[model samples]
Target: MPRRPISPQLLARQALALLIGYASARVALWLYLPLPWMLGPMFGCTVAALAGAPISGPNQLRMIVIPIIGVLLGSAITLPVLLSMPGWWPAFLVLAPFLLAALAGSYVVFRRLGGFDRSTAFFSAMPGGLNDAMLLGAAAGGDERRIALAHATRILVVVFLIPLFFSLVYGATGSAGGGNPARNVALSALSLSDWAILTAAAALGYWGGKKLDLPAYAVMGPMIVSGAAHVAGIVHVAPPTQLVNLAQLVIGVVIGCRFLGTTFREVSREMAVAGASAAVMIVIALAFAVPVAAIMQMPATQAFLAFSPGGLAEMSLLALSMGEDLAFVSVMHLTRIALVVAMARPIWRWVARRGEKDGA
Candidate 1:
């Protein structure tokens, strides 16, 4: 039998349907369900996936991915500078070159992943949510499957390690009694001013995400905007203590879902390689994070979460749980992603040029 090609028009309609469904889910989640933010997207994706809805679309997944890029930019790039600076001017000084090098180095390694080209691999290897990353990868002309796999790998590693890491660092057994409440309650009580700042930061993040053409702008953009707000002394909202646990739950479910139909025997080699790369990335991140945190006089746990290569939501959740600084972690993760994506295209093009010159 010959393969039939799908015309662009039919494809567009399918995509439109998916988008409508996904948007409906997201709005419902935000307004009525009050589930974890992660769950909102997951719910949409799950419905689409289960219904055998074609993944090819101009739907919620793609929209979600765009804002995430902003989140990565905010977390990894902007927040660090804000935290490090004696003033705002000095922050940019540190940010510019750091972003350039990270993107350049990571892209070089990502391209060498055999089947995956630079864009897809870069987005896949990026430290964030799988669905969001895959959507971003697709928008950037990446192999969505590979990106999804890479994200899955990262999530698996984080789920296995974070609890253990927390145990090691905090010297607490895996028990509910380890947490504190009075402090958490105080943190949860967001003031009117704090809400204003959060809203403002979210708006800025969304705008920046759109301008920069990053993925999952809603989550990512808000993170950056809010982070910047905190740094600028416009808001003093900390992570709600309940949100820490909520974040972990979100990550665990999301990561576990990816493994549902996958067989270890089939993906063994790919899994191993992905796991190794992810571990290397995490270690390298930790190396940078510890010293940076020390230099800035930040708590080690907060720094660790800030620096951890776990997905955006996971690390942020951990930060919230430990009563660590969510603003700091959110900014760190956001920046790392933003810089890497921003710089990847130019670096890939340079590599392509160099390859052509060598071939010639």
Candidate 2:
């Protein structure tokens, strides 16, 4: 008998299945997991994709673009707080080593895993801007899809495990009152004027980042512009609630889209190795962060988020919700991004050369 043709209805059902798979994973993580929101969505996407969903499409741009914008908006929250501080330069000096070690350690883990190259493992494991990492991966000729999946898996594992670990080890202390200690910001609500200012900042930041080729345009751009706006007193208000929700939704949807057609069949032994490498990368990062967290006198969960080889938004979100040092996580995450970007080319080359020598 001739095989029946795949109808539009079937395609639609498949699409919905993909979406549901991803969404369910995310909702579970968002509700139950201890990780950040940004990480949850990516985790959902990977799970959905692994479950035979069709998230990966011809338009890869959407997968990469939205997260960039979302990250910018999220990171913008830090700008006003950071600018108000004294001796920002000195702060950077203190953070530089930790970030470098995180990135370098990631590379070492990647090299140790034989099937993949340094670029793939490094970009996959490097915790920073998700959008920036994807772009960097593409530029370095690393597999964007694999990197995306690896990133998603790391996020999922951390999100699912970290909170439980803390609760089991440290005991659940209710919602962690994580935020900047110095900032007298209000999260109850925001005025219309504040919303307008934030919107303008996001728009202008998007424009400027595209023009200047900044890393993680959406988050970074909006952050810089909005921060400047606050510093200049043009937008002297906190971020609005509606804008925050919108940013979360967009980021969640985009991250979820990646899980379109994932399944166990698709997860090859090599991919498993890559995932293990990513997990290893996270462990190494955690080890490096313990001393720093102790020196800084931060809580264990806060230290884990700060040092975990997870994305910036994910770690910061976890920190903020758990009532840890949001600013500290933000600064640490930014430092990691800057360090990775600065050293990406050399790292990529090193990985590539190493892979060749190893006949990978």
Candidate 3:
């Protein structure tokens, strides 16, 4: 099937949204906010959207930017980081239990407090896999709109709060790997050969990952390919800081634009429910993160980012911005999403059957 053509009006809206995002980023930088390029755009676009602006998500642009982020993340995976993977078993071991606890706690909050139906509450309570939850929830006779809104609200709240928490509590700022002056190279610093390698990795990785149907393939594919090249010592430079910041701006805009067509009346109740559920999940995440950090002998922020119920891309970006272990955080989020995708439906089905039996 051929792709549909985008309308000029839609293009105009997208441009306007990007302009707002960029302007917001500059203001945020002037004010010295943490992760200004991202958070600034996110806040600006969200406010615009809620005010009934004709904003549309730059989905096509975001696809292009995602590969850039993937390459940036891949550059963090050095040979020693790859070798240290074995020691992360404890964190990995706790992920399943942590997910279960988050799901159960959130389910209770959604059902009891939010008054959501069983299917809606259960799927809305998922710790990850937003798309999956919406699809499955709709198929299971839940309200699709509610499920989507709940998940979107969860991502927005989690992404917005995590960085602030780190900045305020831990004094961590977003400097792209803790202000590593060496990593702040401009685009002009890259050799032509380096550009070719990076370009090939982004293109080939995206192609291969899509062919294999990997989750979050746009980002994951490039990350894997770039990571391999980095580990092999084939590439010695990261993408330019300017490009990375642009990528962040685009991603923030995409996330905030999710609310474009929503009204406060339509989403107020659902947002409240999802926000409360997100809080429950965050507490559970911290509960697990503290102990896991001790056992893994890493910063608590790293573990928290790994265990947070935020989207894979969002959490990984936070890790990258905060100078945390991007490799570990990305892997853990991949695992969480994969687990939710594989297990949520079967678990929900079992619960449904039990409910049926009890009622009968």
lDDT of each prediction vs. the true structure?
0.53, 0.57, 0.87
Q: Write the per-residue lDDT of candidate 1 for residues 1-360, one digit (tens) a residue.
A: 976777787567445444544464356445533223333334454444435444433333333333432332333334455555453232234444544443344444566654557577567565554555666668767787767766677666664465566667665322231123333434447787765565456567778766877654566656657556656666555444344333333333334345434556666666665676666665665666566666667666666666666666556545544556555666666665566556555655675577578772
Best by TM-score: 3
User: How many clashes in each candidate?
Assistant: 32, 20, 0
lDDT of 2 by residue, 43-159 (tens): 555556566654443223333344333433343455556655453343345455655565665555555764556567678766555666788888888888777776666555565
Q: Which residue pairs in candidate 3 have backbone atoms (N, alpha carbon, C) closer than 3 angstroms, thus clashing? A: none
Please give the lDDT score for candidate 2.
0.57
lDDT winner among the candidates?
3
Model 3 scores what on Cα lDDT?
0.87
lDDT value, candidate 1, whole model: 0.53
On a 0 to 100 scale, what is the lDDT of residue 42 in model 1? Answer: 46
Off by over 4 Å in 1: 1-123, 127-142, 169-215, 221-251
- Candidate that beats the other on TM-score, 1 or 3, i.e. the better one: 3
Give the Cα error of residue 96 in candidate 3, in Å: 0.7
**Residue-by-residue lDDT tens digits, candidate 3, 25-103:** 8888887676778888988998899888988889999999889878987888899998898999998898999999999
Q: What is the lDDT of residue 49 in candidate 1?
A: 40
**For candidate 2, what is the TM-score?**
0.71
Report the lDDT of model 3 for residue 176: 31
